[model samples]
Target: MMHLTSRYLISLASFIVLTSMAVAKTNPACLKHLGGGYGDAECYHGLSADITADNDKLYRNLRATIPLGNAHQKLLNDYMASQNDAIKYCELQRNAGAQWKAEHDGSMFPALYEQCVYNIRKTQSTFLQDLLKMANWK
Candidate 1:
């Protein structure tokens, strides 16, 4: 059951990231579509998905640099484990958001949460990119 759940989550995450990736690549920039709330949310969600995909690709590239061995297999396994761990992170994010919404009680909660998540993903993507550079990968 646990394995199936992780597999499902991975598939779902892949679908989302790949789906948004196309729009994300075309824009390059998530230039805020202001006035319309839907547009701004789209910007945040799209950019977040893009950054998530970027981080995944960078880590995969880093792993690829390692020759096939026990260590390589371990890295591959760790990547899947990390994806499973992301479910826990999402739970934490929701809990924190609930607390904040309870205190503030505004329409901005959803957008603010999405923006915060985007920032976190962006940071992770940048960090992964730096790691790739340090490894001399293109």
Candidate 2:
């Protein structure tokens, strides 16, 4: 009886570990949507690093590069407002992912959310670059 119980326990433990791994595996579709340039790791991890660096650059550029003037100030204010809206949209996407019911594992939700955020940030970065051009900044 003792030996049988030990074998059962080992099998149960192995099953749990395998199940956890299956659940935790990143969705390949989500990774591809996010550019899939991170090799073995998921795209969210790479995108997280990218978005952080981009946000830092955007912050610094907005703070120091744009000259102080009425036109520039107006542009900056509008950009900031758009940023706030983008943030809200990103949050909505994240919430949707969290509440998604179709996926059994739900591992793709986070990667999808991160992809959405990455796209938003990338768009914002492009807009900022355009603004820089308009301001005649090299």
Candidate 3:
């Protein structure tokens, strides 16, 4: 019984490692940015799985290739600033949409909120992509 259990445990561990490697290749950035729990496609509310996968690829590439040091720090800071701005902008838009929906007695579309977030992410990704090109990352 002991021998059988040890072999089973080893097989399980190997399977887990291989599965995660495959998943990482498909959505490498999701884990780096969102961490383990929220990294999967199910966490991306509005966008289709395909779109999220593409964004993950872009983010992963940017993260992997970005040069290190002060310039990289500055780039990260700029991204945070943009995120703050996006938050405010999205809040205003959401409020407005809420009021309009209320007036028209329409159902709330949760996807709208997700779409807003996705747009901000896309913009930030594009900026980073440009920066990466300028820095000549291979």
Compared with the true structure, what per-residue lDDT tens digits does model 2 show for residues 25-128? 34435554543333323565455456546666775666576566657667677766777577556556756766745444545555565667667766777877
What does candidate 2 score on TM?
Answer: 0.49
Model 3 segments more than 4 A misplaced: 2-76, 100-107
On a 0 to 100 scale, what is the lDDT of residue 135 in model 1?
70
What TM-score, to 2 decimals, does candidate 1 have?
0.54
Q: Per-prediction RMSD in angstroms? A: 12.0, 11.8, 8.8
Top TM-score model? 1
- Candidate 3's TM-score reads 0.46
Candidate 1 on 16-90: residue-level lDDT in tens?
A: 999886564525455634443555556776777777777778878877766778576686567546653554454
Candidate 1 displacement at residue 5 in angstroms: 48
Instruction: Estimate every model's Cα lDDT from 0 to 1.
Output: 0.65, 0.62, 0.56
